[model samples]
Target: MSTGHTSVPEVLDALKDVTYPAGKEQLISAARQAGAGDEVVKALRGMPAEQYAGRAEVARSVRVDPDSDPGTDAGRRAGQARRGGKPGLSQHLREEPRTPIQEEFDR
Candidate 1:
């Protein structure tokens, strides 16, 4: 990782071989094994200690554009544009919608 901010593609590349729903330790280990530098590793360490289901999930956790590819410079620019310059993490953990039966019980 460079001294600058870590890119979403870079993080994803570091976790290419990581299993789904990976824990914090698993993610850090995978990133290290993939040759991630201190910046990238620090970013991973700062992420919420929870299981990530996929790259998209990790992207969201790190406040990157989940839809854009970070592999190329152009892609990184596109992702940044898609992000609209917003910084910090958004609400990733959401409550599941209740079924009709559950709603009725609440009522």
Candidate 2:
């Protein structure tokens, strides 16, 4: 996956004025009107043609570099900040089912 640093931010920044409940064509048009460069426009082009409920969905549709950060989530991607592993590997491998265990333990 490409580093998200250059993708989502640029796209979102270009789309800041866009309203929600937009379609593929609307997004592309808006992005272009907002003076988005080729990279942001190209990312928006890759999205599936459908009605988007909000910016979050649009962000989800756009591919971003998920593993570059070292936090507690998105660890299945490997090299992310995971909490556990065998040896000499990143700790946040996410080998365990995080949601179910956390849910069970929470109550």
Report the C-alpha lDDT of model 2 over 2-56, residue by residue, as the tens digit: 3334467788898899898998889989999999887787777766778888888
lDDT of 1 by residue, 1-107 (tens): 24366766788888999989898789999999999977778778767778777888787776333234334355454555554433334322222345799999999
TM-score of each: 0.56, 0.56
Q: Which stretches of candidate 1 lie over 4 Å from their true place?
A: 1-3, 63-107
C-alpha lDDT of all candidate models, in order: 0.68, 0.68
The clash numbers for all candidates, in the given order, read 0, 6
> Please, what's the RMSD in Å of model 2?
8.8
